[model samples]
Every structure is written in structure tokens, then in C-alpha cells.
Target: MPRFTSRPLAAAVLAGILTPAIIAPHAAAVDYGMDPDVVQNPADTPNRPETSGSGPSMLTQGSSDGTVTEGLINDYRPQTVNPMFPEGRDHLPTADIDMDPEVLARLAEYAKVDGDRIRQINAYSPSMGRTIPLVWIVPQDLSEPRPIVYALGGGDGGQGRDNWITRSDMVDFYSEKNIHVILPMLGAYSYYSDWLEENPDQGGKQMWETFLTHELPGPLEAELGADGTRSLIGMSMSGTTALLYATHQPGFYDSVASLSGCGDTNSWLGRRGVASTIYNGNGTPEMMWGAPNSDYSRYQDAVINAGRLAEQPNLYVYAASGLPGDLDFLGPNAPADDGAWDDRRGPGFYIEAASNLCAHRLKQATDARGIDTVYYDFATTGTHSWDAWNNALREFWPIQARGFGIDGGSVTPGLDGEEAPWVGSSDSSRYTDLFGPSSEIYGGSTAPALSSRLDDPSLSSQSSVPDGSSDSSGSSGSSGSSD
Candidate 1:
């Protein structure tokens, strides 16, 4: 990952008046249209007091005849808890079941013969603390190691774990497809980043990037027989993390699918944004990047990274959004026709702005690289919410399944070689290419570790290779996500 060099906090391009960022299917639907003027200078000024007389603190204004009238005031309070943040994963009570031991036994027994069932597994993140609150459902019928699909809530409207998966149709979909499903407990505001600056100890508790790419996989391999056949499919923020993970750690996952994911970290924070207070004081893009306007390093806009991964043909990409009415949480009660503005109580408030730009740039970049790309533009009336994501997920599954070398017909190579694996960055400064080397953390493992472990067939022999035959890009996979 190249360090961010600029600091004029990249402003979010809004959809329209009274609307949030949005990526609708229709060309006339106005996926996202922002007034460039809305962007602000990050260094302009800190939140200074602009006071008027109206009682003790309220900002009031003197009318034409010196009459005092209460007027709008600008008092920026620190955002301690993000509304988009899930309630709490700190000490989330685990199910009474002993998941790890049971899963290992099941894997040992199943390795002999082909079988499938309610395969229970655990997922961990160092920042999420010691307890393993995450559980997965793997179908029994898969012959080889299937693609891993990670689902969660947090970005835009999909935050909080309690209702995130249950509220939608994903659990059923996973069961139907037999795709290895990873369900993490990301509530609304947790961007799933290892927040180094937010902790009092600066312990990097939020270092989920390390856990997912390293710690969690070992257990999955021990239990469910995961041999690098992985894919992350999620909504909103988790969706963005899916792409960032693919970009930062190439060769880890064969494909990445994002439904209504954000394009840049700065989009979440308004212009002149605060790092710690809003993102839980875990070091804003500036702090994470070690300079001003450094959001790119953390979130890693897909537009920039995809170009770097151009050679990696196995890197499949998919993005989609729902029609207008389909996006409403409660159907008609939530109207889809809100212009791009901050109508907090209204539907499509925040997600609209971010996902629109993200999907657009992601598609543009992938398409330019001649990477096999799939973009579904559903039409109807909807907003930026789970309902929309659910719809989008259903539409996206076919593409995702194909990426796993499942849905698509046997992928025969063309006479001309398909895309090759992306090599590390040519620029020494930006060494963290999609599958390149990087600094280590949390005792994380590298692609080399995965390769070395492949020598033994402790897992299924079929699990060694990714699905059907494919080309190798010789890329080294690592871990990371935008805070």
C-alpha cells in the first residue's frame, strides 16, 4: 500500500439535493452526482465557535429590526459512538456449543469420505479481543475446498450483527449454494480496521486485517479444510473490506464481491473530518498514513489498486445495487426519491454517496484492465439500506459462484493467455502490492506459509488447488483494511 501524500480530505461526491451517495442502475437514476463545490478544505479551520445571542448558548440572530431570533448554530460535538456502528462485539456472549473442537473432529471424520452438513466454525479478530464470537455454516456436498464467503453488517445502513444476517436472506442463500460462509460480528460503525490510534494502549485492537488473513484461516484449515479457496462477499462497509482485503492480500481470496461498498475512507468522514472521534479515535486516514490526505492507504480506493492487479486474472470482481422500491426497509413507508443530501431521518441518507462512486470507479478500473468483471444494475425504486443489499446479493451470487469456478461453465483458457497474477509494486516506496511483501503484525502468516503448508495433504488433496485448474500470478498475499 502506497502512503497517502495529499491532505485536502477527499470530499464525498453526493447524489443530489437532500440525498445520500447512491448507485442506482438506471443511467437517468443518477447513481451519484455531487456538487464539486461541496468538497471542503481539511485544513481550512477547526470547529471554531460561531455564536449569537439567544438565551445562554443557543445561537440566535437579530432580525431586520434588531429582533432576536434563534438561528442555526455550528457546535461540532465529538462523535463517541457511530450510529452506523454495531451495538457491541466486545464481550459478545458465545453460543454454548464448543465450536472449535467440534469442527476439528468433524473435519477429521469427513476427510475420509465426501460429506457435508451444519459445519460449525469460529472466526477471530485480534482487535475484536480473545473470544471467538463468529460462527460459519459450511455445506457438506462440496468435493474440493470451495470459496469462502464472508458476510457482515456495518457500512452505510447495514450495521449491527444481531439483525444483520437474520434480517436478510443471506443465511438461506449460503445454505443453498454450499459456499463456505463466514459471519463476523461487525455492527454499524466499526469499519473492521485495526484501529491503532483509538486505543489508549495503542495496542492495535482493531487489527482485524491481521486476524482474518492469518489467525482465523489456520483454524478454518484445521476444522473445515480451507486450503486457500476463499472469497469475501458482504454488504456496505464489509463489502469495501472485501475489496481492500483482495487488494492488500492478493492470492488469499480468488474473488471479491461488494454490494453497496464505499469507494474511499474519506467518504465516510465529511470534509475536514476528525480521525479519532468519528472513527473511534483510531487514527484517521491522516494518522494511519502518517501524513495529510492519507485516507488512500487505509481504505485503498479500488480504482487505484485494481490497475495494479491487472495481471491477476483469477481476481474476479462483482458489484451491484437494487432498484428504488426494493431498497426501502419497510417497502413503501421508506420512499426512494430523496436527493443527495443529509436527511438523517430519511432513507438512503449516507450509503448513497459512497457506494455510487465506489461501484463506478471499481467497474471502470476492472473493465480497463480487461479483468473479467460483472456489474448488475437493478432498476426499481429503493434506497440505501439492507433491503437493497439483500436484493443485490441475490443478483450477485451467480457472478460470485462463477468466480469460485462454480456457476460458470468449465473455465477454458483462451489461446491468448488470460490475466496473470499481479507482481509487487515496481515503486520501492509502495511495496505493498496486491500480492507483494510487507511489514508483519500479530504474527501474521504470508502466502509463503500457505504454500509451504500445502506440501502436506492433511486437508483434502482436492483442497490444495483453487477449484479447477487456473494460472498462478506468483503474488504474495497479506492483510489490511481501511479504518
Candidate 2:
């Protein structure tokens, strides 16, 4: 056998392929720009507009103050108030679909030790041509279909699965109640919307709204033992997504809950914060909904669409101040040490404060529209961490169970659960004013009469987008309504 030398073989192959004549610069160059057809025009691309620079800078225009001005608040007053959910509309998905087998195989890798009861599956989306990872938890005794709870994660992205299992007792709670909990791992910094443009770094078309609302439900109901009835609960970033989804698709969810959620995205500070978040997450605001002042941004805003949220049968919104509460120091969920507390305090403080401001803004919009379907909880002492969210989840379970039309009495540990050790004590007194009779923090008592145009049966099943509309580049006559 002949002895083979690796270096000499590689050198011979490279030397043969890469000659000096080929590598040398050519004196003559061809100008492809001269041929119009040779170079594809950037403007001709679908839904993509090529601009000179990165459109606009949100940093210069963003507000540092957490609160919106009185003028800005007044600007949102509606010229014509419309009913959110018209009667006789088909709220459920009409199509029958199945998950791709290859996608299912990929999702099976996320399964934990208890693979049968708890398995992570990738839900396929035809619109996006990709699969999103989702952790599914079902009770072993599944003789019949169970009501579904769609739990969305916050800014940290898809951590809701881990959080629901470890940071909170939701697994035990849902297991005992025989409920189906779906936790979607939507990746970090995804605001859970259909992005205006594809993210180059993330490398996928994020059609989250279409996936959740139109695609996932049909398969879930047929194969995953899920009933038609559903509820939505989200924290932080997803809190806003949950609110938008419930409002955008009327009658889809029986109840909706937001924990430490930012609800106002149209305000100067709100828009700024959203822009900043997108930028930090390796994305651009232009890719999300166009410029800060574009119609896409306005339509997606929860505060701008408060009238839609008011139509839901039940709504729960909760937020907290950055201040350390009694539970922060004393509960089983409390920080392990001072260093842990300190580590969480900085971001937690700002996020909680911002969420409080957003909650107030959302309340203002709902109250102005005479929408009264919200249960508000503005804790006086807490942060944006999981501890506050876990507490809110425990407290909101009764309301969630009621929305599912099931007897809430069967929920584990009752209201006396160890998750909330300070439920009835003075330690919880700080949030009393929010739920009191004279609470100005909630919405109005009466709903306004619906306009004829809004009550038209023909328009009930119509899509959220208006007729004769185009993309979000402001080229169309009018920006269509978001569904």
C-alpha cells in the first residue's frame, strides 16, 4: 500500500484549483447596473420597501418619562366607537389540519423524564413555513376533551415552559384540574406578532398571530384532546400579546389575563420602549410594524384597541410596583439570598414600574370607551420577576376556571395554596385599593350603544383588514384594521 501524506495532497488540490491568474485583479470590469433587468429593483420585492437608511431612529424621539402626557392621552379619543365582537360571528377555526410528522419528531427531543404526560412538540405553520416549539401538559386520565389554557412567555422568550414547571406550581395545578396547558417557546424577543419583514438573524417569517389564531387551534382540538373553549394568560412581553390576541379575535377566548404586562404601545414612552426592546433583541422596529408612527404599530397597540378587549366575557390585568413586598422576603418563592434579590432588583424595578404605567394607560382607554369587563390588580409592592407573576397566576386561577365553565372549587390547595402564603394577610393590603368599590383604577360601569355600521351582520365575519388596502409602507389609501 502506498503511504498517503495529508499536507501534500491538500496543497496539490488547492494549488490546482486556485491559480494566480484567477486570483489576480482584472483590468476590465463589467457594470451590471447598466442593464435594468440584470439588477433586480429593490422596490419590486414583495412587501419590502428599500429606503436610504434604517428608516427612523426611535432613540431620539422616545420618552424617558414613564407616563404619557394628558395631551397624548386625549388624542386617543375615538371619533366613532364600534362594538368589538359582533353577534353570530364564527370565532373558532374552520379548517381541519394535522401537524407534519417530521415536525413532531423534532419536537419530541424536548421531552422530559415524564415524556408521556409532558412532551414538547413543534407546531407547524403553513404561512411561515416553519415549526414553533410548544410544551404540552395533559392529565393521564384523559377520558374526555379538556378546556385549553394558552400560556405565553415574556420578554425572555419561551421560558414559560420551564417557568410553569419549576418557578410555579402550574403543572400540579393544571394536572389536578385536568386542564390542557400549551406553553409555546417562541424564542427570545419575539413580541408574538406577524413581523412586517423577515428577521435576517433569526431566519424565519414570524407569522405568530396567524399561527396561534388560525392554524394551531384546529389541530390542537382534533389531536391533542382540547375542547373548543380556551383561555389566554401571559406575562411581561406576552402579556401584551395575550391582550391583543383576545381583543383582535373577538369571542375566541373566554377569558384573558395579563401579568406585569405592558398594554400601551402607541404612547411616546411605550413606542420607545418597544423600539428599544426590538433593537436589543437583534431585530429592527421597521421589521416589526414599520416606523414608530406607522398604521401597523397603531393597529397592533392594545390601548388603541381597548374597545375590542372590553367585548371579552372576562379580562384580568395585573401589575406591580418595583418596591420589595412582604412576600419578596418571606415566601417559599422568595429569593435565596440578598445577592439573588439584588440581581433581580434592577431590571425588575424598571419593568414593574413600566408595567404599572402601561396598566394605568390601558385603564384610561377602557374607561373612556365605557368598557367595564376588567379585573384589575395593581400591587403596591413587588417586582417584574416570576415571584410576582406566580402569585398572580395563583390568584387568577379561580377566574380562569370560571371562564372555562367548570366548577373552580376543585382546583388544588384551594385559595389557601402555599404558592400564595400572604393571600389574606396585611401583607397583601397594598393591593386593596385597586379592587375596592371606589377604585378609579378599573374601567367604567356601562358599555355604550353600538353603531349601526358596527352591528351590520354582513361585516361580522369580515377580516380585520379594510378593503383596497396594501402593505404597511404607507403607500395604500388607508391602513386596514387589524383582526
Model 1: runs farther than 4 Å from truth? Answer: 1-129, 140-146, 156-164, 186-188, 198-204, 266-283, 286-290, 293-299, 311-323, 326-350, 366-381, 408-483
Q: Which candidate is the best by lDDT?
A: 2
Whole-model lDDT, model 1: 0.36
- Tens digit per residue, CA lDDT, model 1, 1-483: 111011111111111100112111111212111112432211112332233422212211111211112221111111222222235343432222225322222122211111233333334334445333344556545676656766654432221112334345555677666666765432223345544344332222455555666556656555555545667665555666666666665556666666555433322221112222123322334433222223333234443345434433243332222223422434322333444223222324324433443444444334333354333232223445545555545545554565566664332221112332222211211323232221111011111123234334442211112112222222122222211
**lDDT (Cα atoms) of all candidates against the true structure:** 0.36, 0.51
Which residue runs does candidate 2 get wrong by more than 4 Å?
1-113, 159-162, 337-339, 409-483
Residue 399 in candidate 2, Cα distance off native in Å = 1.5
Model 1 residue 309 distance off true place after TM-score fit, in angstroms: 4.0
Best TM-score goes to which candidate?
A: 2
> By summed lDDT, which 10 consecutive residues of candidate 1 come out lowest?
1-10
Clashing residue pairs, backbone N/CA/C < 3 A, model 2: none
lDDT of 1 at 350: 29
